[model samples]
Target: MTGWLPVAPCTPDGCARHTGAVRAPLPAALLLLSGCALVLLGVACIPLVRLLGAGPRRRLTRCWARAVPQAFGVRVIVRPHLPDGAPDGVELVVANHISWLDIPLVASVLPGRMVAKREIRCWPLLGPLAARGGTLFIDRDRLRALPAAVRDIATTLRSGSRVVVFPEGSTWCGRGGGVFRPAVFQAAIDAGATVRPVRITYRTDPHGSGLAAGAVAFVGADPLAASLWRVVRAAGLTAHVDVLAPIPADGEDGRRALARRARAAVLGPGDLLQARQTAVASDRANRPAESVHH
Candidate 1:
């Protein structure tokens, strides 16, 4: 990452811990193939999927999303803790970034428009799928283009569309995650939408061990192929998505404040404490270097 782009501290060698049992090479290969086949199948059904009504399309998309991860031998569990009676409007779903798989995990429950980098619109099969799914792309190369992009997102929200964004910007290795970028929250504020913070956590011991499955994170320079293989072979891998209660964007707070509000909601108490501890440890480790430089 360069310039104003966010960079995660997670690196492949340092953070991708391959925890849990291993799958045989043949079975893992088969699982990867099955996942690819599902992708192709989804691509083939694009037209039919587009023709369906919004509600039905979302339902079908949710099922297909769930199936994709299952094909990759990963189980996804959704804890839907929506408030009893939250007013319905445009919803801005913000989630922490973990891996490419986070996309499908989020789509499974909240099938909505995803915000992605502009380059993703040109990829192979996945590119077309995202375009068909009504993705909002951001041109990261041009800071000047952000206002226009924000306006476009606000317009989409005003149309009663749900916009999903990984506010962390870059993928983290599921430890002490990065802070949420505040720019996107402006869209929610402008559109008077409710900001919903969804937390995505990876666990290697799916027997409810709750271990961090950072092994599957596509952080730093890890190639996409390597991440795919790791995910396929990682036995007992499970993804937990906790959909926290929504925070109304109607408050007169600025985007930064809203970002903090949403991020706090996503991290919850446990993660917030972990993050603080991680920061403290990191500071202590760097203290020697700081003294040398001084």
Candidate 2:
């Protein structure tokens, strides 16, 4: 079941030679099935929203995400060490980027509006769900447009919904957290929202048996279908979700300074209290459940 199923590999420019037709029909079918299931679930959620309201609906959304991981033959292992305090008005959460799949992956774990690249807004079925879920899309090439978008994000946070952003700006292969983009971090500072740092890692096991840290990683230009096939061909995957410390919405730190600290906290070593005094402790005033994790 395990062997180096090699293609000619990619050139330095990241283009694969495609010398051999890498058959991915099995993985493709699995992905297509998952997408269909998600679409049905989205439609089913319409009525549920009427019955349960936004609170329960969002909760259900997260629940659906959690269930899909295993149903899709994925596993999630979360180790959260969040900083203490409540964000003053809104919250801006920053996290590492890994794959396109991270969308549903994080969506299942956190109930919030996602900040995605603008192209995602045009995606087939996923686009509609993201838009309905209040996702904010940014066109990276358009710097002029970012200011207004940031303001909009600030407003959304002030209205009391968490906004999720991947500060890395781009996805990478492996467990590595790529270079952090500093622009969007300003929303957290501008809105005085707590900036929570999150790191996500995926461990793949070809044999479908292993611990969290022991699994293989699927990274870098590995097509989704191919990656899934590689994983299915392997054992199983144990995904590690680490919620690092949050930085305060209030501090003497400038935007770049704050971004640096946050990037370090999520990417580098551990520091628990830096996030506590600024955000988490203050948040206890908003929701008692803020302190509790599922």
Candidate 3:
């Protein structure tokens, strides 16, 4: 369905193909239906908390979000590579946000609460579900709230619920990597938990033709529902989620260092194809190196 869309100019440096936006009919209908289902599901689950428990209800919500892409006829590709024996305590997943689909994209693979801006928590149906699901809403403007937010995040992690944060603050086209807002990384530092970085890309190639940067991109001032509708209405959709190894909480290099490393991994090595290969190789190298005694 994505193939039917036209490509536009991508201002991001490394994005080679003209970016395509999603504004199709099929996706529009599916998004609406899926959203309605989500709302209805939440309403139904509200009463079942006694029977299902918060954990079960949360799990169901995650499952519903995971199924959204399919409802819109889009396939989600997730490659999550975690370090061996990563601590079971709370975790912070730092992923790049490309489009509104990112909410579902990140939520689908990562099973945990989210650290989103205050706005998402009030976004009609989703807002209600997210708040009820235990998502930690951060009021970025209120510096006084930082300590409490950190404590809350740490508590959630200690309780075994993961938190996904898009440090960039907002979503962008997947054409290039964006800077990780330093303030958001504080939670991971304060909580003494590992930070896992992830990269996301959406392509039109149904057969996985490397990446079709030209066929899909949602950016700037474009209303979320309208942009998403464009993608759903298109002919085909394929997306990839590359999860890099998690960084230790106590790095000699600070969170900023980890952020730099993560940005490189997501952006690749400048050349698109080369960057992909390099990322794969680097990820392989970062694995706890083994020794062969002579």
lDDT on C-alpha atoms for all candidate structures: 0.77, 0.55, 0.59
Choose 2 or 3, whichever is better by lDDT.
Answer: 3
Candidate 3 per-residue C-alpha lDDT over 1-294 given as tens digits, one digit per residue, 9 for 90 to 100: 011111222333433233444445554686668756755575557556636755565566556667766666568777764332233336788776666667677666665677776866766666787777667777655556656766777777667778887765444455454455454455567677788777777777655665554334455445555554555565557878787777776656775776666566665676345434423432343232111000
Q: What TM-score does prediction 2 earn?
A: 0.70
Best-to-worst order by lDDT is: 1, 3, 2
> Every model's Cα RMSD, please?
5.9, 11.8, 10.4
C-alpha lDDT (0 to 100) for residue 287 of candidate 1: 26
Model 1 per-residue lDDT tens digits across residues 1-294: 223255667788887768668899999999999998998899889899889876677778888988998999998888873332233348999998878888898888777788898767886667888887778887776666767878888998999988888977677787776666677888889999989899888887555676765667888888777888989988888889898888988758888798888878887877887765544543343322100000
List where candidate 1 sits over 4 angstroms from the true fold.
1-3, 81-89, 276-294
Query: Candidate 1: lDDT over CA atoms?
Result: 0.77
The digit string of per-residue lDDT tens for model 2 on 197-244 reads: 776666544332333321122333444444444443333456667767
Candidate 1 residue-wise lDDT at 63 = 81
Which lDDT value does model 1 have at 268? 81
TM-score of each predicted structure versus truth: 0.89, 0.70, 0.72
Query: Which number leads on lDDT?
Result: 1
